[model samples]
Target: MKKKAMASFLIGYTLLFTGSVYWHGQQFSQPIASDAGQLLPTAVKSIEQAEGEKQLQEMVRRANRTGDKLSIAGMQHSQGGHTYYPGGTIIDMKKYNKILQFDPKRQTITVQAGATWDDIQRRINPYGLSVKVMQSQNIFTIGGALSVNVHGRDIHYGSLIDTVESFRLLTAAGEIINVSREENKELFPLVIGGYGLFGIILDVTFSLAKDELYETHTRVIDYSQYSSYFQNAVNSSQVKMHLARISVAPDTFLREMYVTDWTNAKDEHKLTAYNQLKEDRIIAAPKLLLGLSRYSDWGKDKFWELQRTYMKKGNGKLETRNNVMRSETAFMEYESSSRTEVLQEYFVPVSEFADYIDDLRNVLENEKDFNLLNITVRYVGKDEQAVLSYAKVDMFALVLLINQGRSSKDMKQTEEVIRKMIDITLQHNGSYYLPYYSYPTKDQFDTAYPHSKEFFRMKRKYDPDERFMNFFYREYGQ
Candidate 1:
């Protein structure tokens, strides 16, 4: 019996891993483009590689000459059509990546826009330095993160905009200009979260932080108690990084929650003991488990139970900051022609968290085909540095991952639920993230982002010809 069970497990693992490899490794045919969401496949004029600044400038000039709109693409992780436009040229920046400068004394690094956080981590990990603010996954490019002005688990920082020192931009007219807080200050805020409508970000200089060791802590509590718990225990303590997961399992379903906090290690000497950067490992098993959670309620309950057990076992583990930033994403890879996983984030003022969660619970419970998979919560300090900033106040961001079919009916159902969620967000004085599909009405967007008119106006002022464009601009700018 034991041998048969072991054989069955091995066979399942092999099939799952093989499927993942095949899906992730497939290549697309020419003139076809899509973002990571795989929801909107577009036919484009051409896709071009960006080799250097001069080459990029020439490409932009040629696009303007030919009346072809240009869109910038990095790792293309955005669920929205932010990276491509129909009949437009895509400037692929992945190969233009290179570290331009690093100042060890000041703890600053400048790199080409195409450089991924992973590239920067490998270079600076040896010097005991790390990125101050970035997304949870390292596969995303710096340009893409800056365009979105992303945030992560760090409690000490505000958002990615706070750490950016300077960057060079290639405007629509093929002019390269240096932009920073001190010089070209007006354009500074407009471009960070401008969603590639401004221009192509060439290279960026960012402030860095010293690498430190952290001791992990985890606790399970009622969903209502989370806001108060974070305020009193996590924020007022030595916790440097924190995030929480509200249960999506059928049994718990927004009632049970677990918080993970990383505080300074009790032993400073342990920093060196675990300072080496860690890479993702043993992903196939987790991928299999996530697949189970995506399809069945029983699988979700078991997955939740296993997740709690995993977090419990990880309590008090010591890890370096770089290793923590290198969060595993391989296990979440999903590829299906008929179905896909989509992410939508909502941010509510800290005071409105419980109320917002209550409404969210009601909505999810009533919608049977919603296929809500996971919800991870992170805190963002009040930051208005970016013109399109999402965190107007000290807010709790709920990142929701849902599985949906590809049919028109499925999309309509998904959009309806999303609009309902957005309406709830507005009622709670909150905002939804713009990196996803354009499900919210124009009125909802204007209400959430009052300064969006100014942002779009500036986009036209900077590029009157509309040489730089994407589906995001088409959805909101016009």
Candidate 2:
């Protein structure tokens, strides 16, 4: 009987190992690309995921010695080539993740650059604290988030830089410098939203918020009414968080919109442990829906409608702030072989929100091949610190999730439509985000970010050799 049991266990183990190898092999053999799975060469030299600051420094030193360029990556979610360089050293920052410290009294947490917001939440939730600002999703690493100066649903907070207390930066010349608003004030803005060009981020200290219970509510309204609705009913101290979703279907399109609100809950109960909420439980259904939506437009429309009507109808569902902020499994399930989904964001002044939406609808409606999966609108106040800051003025951010084929022809068509979209944004005196694909021309980029000249000039002054570089700089750093 003992021999039979051993045989059974060994056979089961062997099958599991074989299956794991096959799954990994499929993923590896598909292609060499970013998360978007577009604009990639055949392969890269190698990837080294640094485990700590020592390892990261050694890798940078080796690259400097060998005259090899280095690419910085954490989660590699930036659809464009900002995180990669062909035939260059790739320093993967995910393994370097570590939470250094948490001060409950001060309501601040200090963490390694690679630590994700999810990591921070796990430690601070017990203390009844939450992050002040982060992107809608929490899967991105702290370093990557700061690199982009990401924003969140918090209408009051502008961007990640606002909540940042300080950070340690490892320069290309192998010098670790501490920067903040009060100390090393000049370099502070350069590093934030700098896209990791100036140097490597060691760790960051961020301010935290109280973790209180929130009651959520949802309503559908016309796109035209959003501006006045926001002024009259939405923008107030009572509303803690809010976001609007617009229909992408060709028929109704941008005409219809829905607003979801999360306010401070009046009656609260014992909060659930952050670790106990299984993130994967809510992701499977959405992944399956997305896969099915790929087959038909009606399926896609149904998915969006379902999301607004049923999924987002909070109806006073009480949840802790930490629970509402947790998005570990929110956006990590896009694993497709044939097609890839990429993000594009445009920031228009709040007053021009409706007009911008009208123009976006016209282009999306006219472009036959443009497959817009989702559109989310968030309010962001002006942020002047980040040199390449996208939110230069009080604006409404139009975040678009687009799906496209892997072929160059399809990408070209997508780029053409995106150029038109950029043109529309430019006409409205807005700017496009730099984290996505390299679709915008040099002229468009300059128009959007007029500070590029000064930004690159500072980059040259700091790293004269241009040792720190990425695809974004290569294309538009002139």
lDDT tens digits by residue: candidate 1, 197-221: 8899999999999999999999899
Give lDDT: candidate 2, residue 326.
Answer: 67
lDDT of 2 by residue, 137-232 (tens): 777899999998898887878988999999999888877889999888899998999998988899999999988777888898899989888877
Candidate 2 off by > 4 Å = 1-33, 268-278, 282-285, 328-332
Error of 1 at 356 (Å): 1.0
Error of 2 at 109 (Å): 1.0
The predictions' CA RMSDs to the true structure, in order, are 3.8, 7.4
TM-score of each: 0.94, 0.90
Per-model clash counts, in order, read: 0, 0
